[model samples]
Target: MPELIGIARLAAESPSLLGKKRVEYMSLTTRSYLTRCNNPRMPFRWMINPYRGCEFGCKYCYARYTHEFMELRDADAFEKKIFVKSFGPRRFLGELRKLPVGESIAIGTATDPYQPAEALYGVTRAMWEQFARTAGFRIGLVTKSNLVTRDAGVIASASRRHAVTIVVTITTLARDLAGALEPLAPRPELRLRAIRTLARAGIRVSVNLAPVLPLINDSEASLDAVAKAAAEAGAVSLGANVVYLKDCAKSIFFPFLEAQFPALAGRYQERFRNNAFLRGAYPEMIRERVGRIRRKYGLDSSREAAEPELWPRDPQLTLFS
Candidate 1:
C-alpha cells in the first residue's frame, strides 16, 4: 500500500508546489462502468455518464451517493478517485442503438462530462462523435467546464440532425465564492465565454443557475446579474433553482456554508432539516424571480416537456400500429 505524506513535505520537495500547502491527496484507477438513473422529473429517461466521480468538487454535489455504492468511505477521496470508462463510448453507442432511434438522451446527468480529467481521457468526445451520425433524437448536455468548446464543431453538426441544447451552469458571479463552492471546475467567465462560442456557432445555449443556495446565492441582485450575463452571452433560455441538500451532500455543503456564510447556516438547517427537496415556497419564489429576470432580459424559460413515456420503447414499431 502507498503511504500518505503531509502536504508540506510534498510541496517542499515536489516541483508541483503552488501557494500554501494543504489537504492530503491520493489516487486510484478503475475500468468501464455505467449508471442508469430512473429520472421521472428530468426531460430524459436515460443518462450517459462517461466518468464515475467528478473532479470539480462542488460542495453541493448530489452524486456523492454514488461513491457509497462503490464502497468508497471517504468523501474527499471520491473527488480524486475518478474512474474512466475506456470503452464507454462504444458500449453506450451500442446500448443507444438497441433502443428506439428517436429516444432522448441526456449526457452528464450524474457527473460533469467535461471535467478537467476529460482533457486526458477523451471519452466524451468519442460519445459525441457516435451521436453525430444519428438523427431525430434529442440530446442535452449540462456542464460547467469550458472544455466543451473543443467539441463545438461536432456539437454543431449533431444539432443539424437532432435537437441539441447545451446548458452552462453558473451559480455565483463572485470569483471567490465560485472558487470556494466549485474548486476544480472552470471559472465563471471561462464558462460564459464558452457559452458565447457555442451560441455564435448556432448551437442552442442556455444558462442553468441551479441549486441556488439560500444566503449564499439567493439574493435578487445576484440572480438578475446571472440572467443578464446569460442574455448577453446569447443564451436562448435561462433557468434557476434553489439548493436542496440530500444525504452525503449535507456533509460536504454545510461546512462550507458555516465557514463562508455563517449567518445563513442556521436558516438552512431549520428549513431543510427533514426534507431533502427544498420547501415548496422556496421553488415558488425562485420561479417567480427567475421568470421576472427572463422577461426582463427577453430570455426564454429553459423548461421542456416531460420525458416521453415510451422512452425505452421503439417509435417505429408504434408508427404503423
Candidate 2:
C-alpha cells in the first residue's frame, strides 16, 4: 500500500475554513517547532515560523520555494495556500529546552507570524505566552505587520525571562512603492508607527531594509529616509541586504517586473540570469551606504546583545545549568 499520508495528502484532505481574500489556511501537524539553521552566515542557530506560506505575496519573496515541499507547484500557491502548523505547547517547550543555552531563535524567518490569519488562530500569541515562562534564550521576532504592536505586553513579559529583539522589516519609506511591492502587507507608515510603539514599550527594536531591489528602492535618498525615520522612532539599529533572486523568486518577481516596471525588467533579468547574488562592488556599495546611514542616525549596525543583567538568575532558567 502507498504511504498513508504526506504533507501534500494532508493539505488536500483538510483546508481550514478560516479564509482571507484570495488566501486559505491549511492546518498541518508538526513533530517539532524549532528548526536548526546550519547556514554559517545566519547569526541565528534556530528558527520558528508560526505559519508556512505568506499572504503578503511580495513579488521578490525568496521563501516561495517552500511550497514545493508540499507538492504545491503553482507559484501563487505559496501565498494563497497558507499552511498553519498545529501548535503543541508541551512539545514546543520541550524542544526549546533541548536547544543550547544562549543560541538565537528567530520567529517569522520564513513567514509572518502576524499575518491576517493570526487574528483568528492566535498561534503566534500562544507561542509568546509560552516564552513568557521560559528564560536564557535569545529570541528575535521579525514581521511587517502592525499587528505585532498588539502583543507588546506579552513581549515585555517574555523579556523578563529571555532576551527578545523585535525586527520590523520596512523595505521603503514610500507608501506607493511599498504598496506595489508588498501589496498585501501593512502600509509603511503603519509599520513605522508599530516600531515607535514597540520602542516606547522598552522592547529592543530594529528595522530591516532587506532585499534592496536595485533600480526600485535602492537610492541613497530612499535608504536615508528609512534610516532617518527608524532613528526618530527610537530604533536601536538598521540592517539591510541587497536583493538576491533564486529561481523560485524569479518566476514570480520577473513577471511582476514586466507588468509594473517594464523599463527595468530587462536589466533585472540580465543581472540575475547568471547568478542568484550580485557580486563585486554592488554589495560592498550597499554596505558602505548602509554604514553611512547608520552613522548619520547614530544607529548600530548589528542587533543589540542581551545585557548581562537581563539574564535570569534562576538555575532552572538555563537549558544546561
Candidate 3:
C-alpha cells in the first residue's frame, strides 16, 4: 500500500461521526481553514471547504479528485464518505490576517459548504458568523443546496461589510433529469427559491448552468428555460460552461452516462479521449448560446474595478464555482 501523509494521514486517524443510509460522515482536523490557491489561472487567492466530501452525489462532481489525497479510491466513497473539518474562531481570525488586503476568499471550493453536513456540524455557519464581524473583504460561496438560505440573516450580515457573491448552481430545470443527475441534491425549484431569498435580502446572487452536456440538456430551448427561471427568481447573472471531464471525474461520470444515456456514451468517449477540454466549435457554440440566453434575460454580472471578479469560477470552473 502507498504510504499516507498529511491530509491522508489525518483522514485515516479521524473518527467516524455518524452514518446515514449508505453514507458515513467523519471529522477531519486541519492546521488551518484557508487553503492558499496556487493555480495561477485561478482568480481567487484562497479557497475554503468546510467539508471534504459531499453527499449531494452529483455524478459529474469534479472535486472527487480531492479524496485521492486521503487514499480513498472507492467510486461511491466520494458521496458516501464525508469529512467535516474542525473549526476554531481564533484560528480563522488569524488566517484572515495572513491574507493580503483586497484579495478574494471563496467558500465551498471543493465541496458544498452548506451540504447536509453543515446543518449538523455547523462549520460553514461558524465561518460566516466570523465573517459577519469583519469588513472590506471579497468572499464568494457556491452551493447547490437550499440549506444556505437557513443562514440568510448571517450571510446578509456578512455581506453588509464585504463584497459577497453567492452562486447557486442549477444545471437544468427538468425536475426528473435533475433528479437523475444529482440524485441526492435539492430540487431545481428549491435552488431557484434560494436565489430569490438571497436577492430579496439584498445579497448579490447568480445562477450557474454548468456542465452543459452534449445532447442532453444543451438545446437552446433547454438553456432558455433555466435563464428565464433565473430572471424571474431575481438573479443578477446567469453563467454557464461546457463540462470538462478530468480522469478522476470521468471514472464516475462515464459509467453514469453509459447506464443512463447509453446512446451518447460512445460519442462522449471519443470527444474526451484526446483532451479533457473540448476547445473547438462545441465550446464556442455553448458560449454563444449561453451568451444569447443571458442577453435575453438581461443578465449581467456585477463587477467593480475596485474589486475582484467572484465566480461562476470554473475556467468555464470551482476551488470552485
Candidate whose lDDT is highest: 2
Give candidate 2 regions above 4 Å deviation: 1-6, 308-321
lDDT of each residue in 255-280, candidate 2, tens digit only: 99999999999999999998999999
The stretch of ten residues in a row with the least summed lDDT in candidate 1 is 11-20
- Per-residue lDDT of candidate 3, residues 1-321 (tens digit): 778899999999999999888889998998989888999876678899999989998888889989988999887778999999988987887777555546688888789998898899999999988877655568889899999999999998877667888889999999999999999899999999999999999888888898798899999999999989988998888778799888888999899999999999999999998888888898899989998988989988442222333322333221110
Residue 166 lDDT in candidate 3: 87
* Candidate 1 local lDDT, residue 161: 61
Q: Each candidate: RMSD to true structure?
A: 7.2, 2.2, 5.5
How many Å off is the CA of 265 in candidate 1? 1.8
Q: Order of candidates by TM-score, top first?
A: 2, 3, 1
Which consecutive 10 residues in model 2 have the weakest lDDT in total?
A: 312-321
Residue-wise lDDT of candidate 1 within 49-145, one digit each (tens)? 7776788889999888776655565766558666555554566556656655565678887789998767876778887787775555677889999
Provide the lDDT at 100 for model 1. Answer: 57
Instruction: List runs of model 1 lying over 4 Å from the truth.
Output: 1-36, 88-90, 303-321
User: lDDT per model, in order?
Assistant: 0.74, 0.86, 0.85
Clashing residue pairs in candidate 1, if any?
A: none
